[model samples]
Target: MGILSINMDDPMDVDALDAFLKIAEYRSLSAVAKLYGVPKSTLSLRLKQLEGELNTSLFLREGRSLVLTEAGQTLRTHAADILGRCEAARMAVAETLDDASGMLRIGATGEFGTAFYSQMLFAFRRRYPKVQLDLSFFSPHTLYLPERQEMMDAIISWDDGNAGQGGAEQLWTDRFCLYASRDYLARMGTPATPAELEEHQAVMFRQPAGPQLWLLQRDAETLSILPRSDLFANEYWTVKYFAVASEGIAYLPSFFTQIECERGDLVRVLPGWESAQQRVTLRVMRPSALSRRMGAFIDFCRDYFSPGYVFNGPRYYVETIFNPTNTTQTGEQR
Candidate 1:
C-alpha cells in the first residue's frame, strides 16, 4: 500500500489545513467561522476538501456537537506542529525586515489592569507606535482558565506560589499594608496595636471566595483580625478611592497606593505591620519564536518594574522625589 500525501503546491491545501485545525480546536465549523469572520459554508467546504484529500472521516457528528474521529486525532497531533513551524518561519522573515508592528494581546486582572498595567501600556505605546495593544481585563478567578488564556499572548497576574506547570516570570513583589486617609485617622484616632483594628471600619477587597481575614505580621508575631467592613469592592482602585475619601481604613497593595501615599492623600495606618505579599508575574503563553514587537514589550516591562524606577507618567511626583536634581532650586538653596 502507498501512502497518500497532501499537495503543498496548491494554495487551497494550505487554507483547508488551516480551516481543519481551527475546526478541530473549536469542535464546530460555525465557531471557527465566527471567530475568523469567515462564512460557515466556506469552513465546511474546506473541512470536507481536507477530509477528501486525506481519504478519511475527520469528525463524527454527536447530536449538536462534533467530536474528532481517530483519524482526526492523529492529524491534530501533526497539524499544530506544522502550523507552529510555519508561523515561526513567518515571524523570522518578518524580523529580517526590522519592523516591530503587530497586534499584542494581553490579559490581566481588572484591578491590576485599571490601577497599574493600563498606565504602563500607555507608556509602551509612546515608544512603539506601530504595535497595536489589546488589553483585556478578566476576573482574578477566571484569568487563568485555559479558554481565557488562549485569547491572550501574555498574561500579567499575581503569583501566590501555587501557579503549577506554566513558566511565569516574576516581575516584582507587591506588599499589602494597612492604609487610610490622614483625615480618617484624625477623625477615628489611629490604632496603636493590631487588636485596635476592630474599632475602625474597613474598606476591604472583596474576594470571590467570600470574606477574608486580615492577617497582619510584625517581626516574629502574627495576628488575624476580622474588621467590620462598611465598604467592600472587588476592584482595588475602588477600595483605594473609598479609603482616600476617609470612608474606612484600606488594606491595599503598595504599588496602587504609591502615588496616593506620596501625595499624602492616603497614609499608612500601621507602618510597622504588613499584610499579604502578592508576587506579580508576566506569563508568556506563546514562548517560542516571539515576534520583535512582543520581545520589545516584554523588555520594556522588565525595565519599568525594576527597583527604584519611578514612573515618569502625567502626575510625576515620584520622579521629583527619587531624582531631587530634577526639582527646581529654591532661593534658600541658591
Candidate 2:
C-alpha cells in the first residue's frame, strides 16, 4: 500500500478538500451547500473528485443522513491540518509583501480618539495607503468588554491598572494638571496651593454620575477637592476652550494642552501639583500573529510615544512653555 495523494495544483481539488471538511463537520452536503451559498451539485461533484483522487469512499449515505466511512474519518483529520498549513503559508507570503492591504478595525475612547489616536491613525494611513482604517470610539468603561474587544483588531484605551489577564501594551502615561488662561489667573488671582482652589471657579468634567473629586498630589501629600464650578462639560477640548475664554480653572491632561500652553492660550496653574495620571495602552487581540498593517501600526504608535519623542514628555507652564529661552520649536524642553 502506498500513501494517498491529491493534486494540490488543481484549484478544484483544493476546494474539494475544503468542501469535504465542511460536509464532514456538518454531516450534511446539502446543509453545507446551503450555508456556504454553493450549489449542492457543485459540492457533490467536488466531494466525488476528492474521493476519486484518493481512491476512497469518504462517506456512506443511509437514508437522509450521510455518515463518514473509516476512510472519511481518517481523511478528515489530515484534511484540516493540510488546509490549515496551506492558509498559514498563504498568510506568510502576504505578510512579506511590501504593501500591506486590509481593513484594520481599531477602538478607542472618544477623548483619546479625537485628541491623540486620530492624528496617529491619519499619519498611518498616509504611510500605508492600501490599508483602510475603521476607527470606532467607545466609552472607557465599555471599550474593553469582551464583546466589544472582539469587534476590533486593536484598541487604544486607558489602562486603569485593572486590565487583568488582558494583553495590554503600555504606550505612555498621561498626567493631568490644573490649567487656566492668563486672563483668568489675572482676574481671579492664581492659586498658590490646592487650598486656594476652593476660592476659584472650575470648568468641571461632568461624569455620568455628576462631578467627581479632583485628586491632586504634590510630593508625599495627596488632596481631593471638588472645586467650585458653575460650568460643566463632558468633552476635554470644550473644557479647555472654556478655561481659555477666562471662564474658570480647568483640570486637563498635559498632552491635550501642549499647543495651547505653548501659544500662551492656556497656562498650567500649579506646576508642583498633578491632578491625575492615566496609562495609555494598546491592546492587540493577537500580538504574535499580527497582520502587516496592524504590526506597522503598533510599531508606529510605540515609536510615536516612546521616551525622548518630542511630543511624549510633560509640558510645564513656567519651565517648558513660558520660558522662551528653554523651549524648542517642537514645544519641548531643550
Candidate 3:
C-alpha cells in the first residue's frame, strides 16, 4: 500500500504545474530557466517539489536527451491541459480590461501584407503597446481555411475571389498592369492591348477550372485573354521580379509597382489597356460579432489606409468626392 492516500479536496499547485509544463514543452531545464529568466537551481527545486507531490520519477536521462518516463508522460498530458485551461482563464480576465491588451493572431498573404498598408503594422505596435500582434504570411494563390475560425483572428486576400465569407472589410483595389524590364521590352515588343498578351512571353497565375474561377476583366468586358507563361510563381511579388529580370510579362497590381513604374525601372505596357482587378480585403473570423479590440483594429484601418490612398479604386478621380457607393464600376469595388 502507498504511504499516504491522495487528498481529493486539495487545490492544485498552479505555479508548479506551470513550471513543469514549460519544462516538458522545451525538454530542457536550462532552456526553461532561460525562457523564464530564472536560475536553473530554482527550476530544479520546483521540479523536485512537483515530483515529490506526485510521488513519481517524472523524467529519465538518456545521453544528452531528457525523456519523459511513462508516469511522467501521463502527467505531462494532463499538466498541459490544466495549463491551457489556466491560460484561457487568464486571457478571459485580461480581455475584460479597459484597454485592448493581449495577443491578436493574424494571417495574410505575403506581398499584400507588407505592401498595401505596411504603415499599419508599425501603427498597431505603437497604438496597442500591450497587444501582441503575430502575422503569419502565406502565398496569395494557395487555398487556405478562411471561415475565420482556424489559425487566424484576421486575414487579407483578394475580395473578388473570396466573397460571401465572414466579416469582411475592403482594404483596397488596384488594376493589374503589364510589367516587363526595359531589356525584356526591347527583346519582346511591348503589347499594345489585351489581345496582344497571347502573343507575348507571359507568366500567368494559374487558376483551377471551376465555378469559383478568376475572370480577367477590363472596362466591364470579360475578355478571353488567357495568356500563358512557361515560368510561373505563386507570389505576386515574384511575378514582378520575373518581369523586371526579363523572364516574361506579368500582370501585377498597379500600386505595387507605383514607384517602379514612375522611376522607369520597369516599363508599363499598354497604358490604355485596362488590366484585371485585384481586391485587397481584410476578413475577421468571429462567431457572431467582434470584440472591442477587433473593432478598434477595423477603425484603425479605415483611418490609416483612407480614400485617395490604397483603397481608392480606378474609378476614383482626384477632384471628385469619395464615397463607397456600390455602383462604382472598377476592376474591384472594395
Candidate 4:
C-alpha cells in the first residue's frame, strides 16, 4: 500500500516526478537511486515526499515488483513526456552560450580562405581563445551546405544563391593577376606577351577539358586569351599550388598570393601587362540568434582587408593595387 489523497493548490516538483517515473520503470528503488548517483534511502524519501504532495498511493508491493496504481499510471506517462521535453530544452539553450566561446564554422574557396581571409585565424584567436575555428577548403561540394545552416555558420564565397535572399551581403573583393613560380620560369622561360601563353604549360581552374578562354582588361583594351591548360584542378588554390610547384603559369586572385609573390616564391608572369582582374564578392550568412559569433568573424575580415594597410598579426600581405577598382580588398565578386 502507498499514500493516497490529493492537494490541488500545491505544485509537485518536476525532479520528483522524474524520480517517480524512473522508479516505476525500474521497479527497484535501489536501481533508480544508483542510476541517479544518489543513495537508495534518498530515492525512497523523495518518492515518499512526492506521494505525500499528490496525496495518492502511486505504487503497491506485489512480491519483488512495485505495481503502479491508476494515479501512478497517469503520472508515469505524463512524467516521461515532460522530462524528455525538458532535457531537449536544456540542450537547446546550452548551444547558444556563445559567451564568445565554442566552435565557429566558416567556409570559403581554398584560394580565398587560405591567403587573405585567413588573417582572421590569428586575429580571432587573439580575441577569443576559447572559441575554436573550423575552416574548410574548396571542392567536393561538401564545403558549402546552405541547406544545413545549423551546422555551417557563415561562408565567404561568390554572391551565388548559396546564402539565399537577404541572408548574404557583399563584404568586398580580391583582384586577380597572372603568376608563375620562379622555378617554373627558370626551366620553361616566361611569357613575354599574352600571346606566348599558348606555347607554355599552363595550370587552370576547375573545368572539364579543352583550351580555356581568358579575358584580360587594361584600360579600354581587352585581351581575350584561348590559352592551353596543361594541368587542371577543382579549385583555384590548387591551381596556384601547381604553379608554385613549378608545374606552370597560373592566374591567381591577388590577396592570398601577395605574400608569396613578394617573397619571390611565385613571381609575376606578366608584370608589365596586367592579367584580367577578377572581383568576387564574399557572401556570409548566419541567421537567427548566432549573429554575435558571425559578427566577430565579419569584423575580423573587415579589419584585415582594410586596403593597403598590412595586417600586423600572425599573417602577412603586401600593398599592391592593380588599377581602376581599389578599396579594402576582402573577397571576390564571382
State each model's C-alpha RMSD to the native. 9.6, 13.4, 11.2, 15.3
Q: Mind giving the per-residue lDDT tens digits that candidate 1 earns over 262-324?
A: 877778888999875677888888888578988998898898888866666653211112323
Q: Which segments of candidate 4 are over 4 A away from where they belong?
A: 1-99, 116-118, 137-146, 158-167, 183-189, 208-213, 235-238, 272-290, 308-334
Cα displacement (angstroms), candidate 2, residue 63, comes to 48
What lDDT would each prediction earn against the true structure? 0.75, 0.76, 0.64, 0.65
User: Which ten contiguous residues of candidate 3 have the minimum total lDDT?
Assistant: 312-321
Cα deviation of 221, candidate 4, in Å? 2.8
With a 3 Å backbone cut-off (N, CA, C), the pairs that clash in candidate 1 are none
lDDT for model 4 comes to 0.65
Q: Which sections of candidate 3 miss by over 4 Å?
A: 1-92, 95-98, 117-119, 138-148, 206-220, 287-289, 308-334
Scanning candidate 4 in windows of ten residues, the lowest lDDT window is: 325-334
lDDT of 1 at 290: 79
- Candidate that scores best on TM-score: 1
Q: Flag regions of model 1 displaced more than 4 Å.
A: 1-93, 160-164, 315-334
Lowest lDDT block of 10, candidate 1: 325-334
Query: All candidates' TM-scores?
Result: 0.67, 0.64, 0.61, 0.55
lDDT digits (tens) for residues 1-334 of candidate 3: 1232233566558888777766775689988887667788988888887777767777777776577787777877787678657756756787688987766767676655556545566676677777777676655444255322354667766654663466577876677766776667776787776677777887665433421222355565775455665776655666666665566877777777776666565777776554565677788876354655666777776676677534322321111123233133122111
Error of 3 at 11 (Å): 9.3
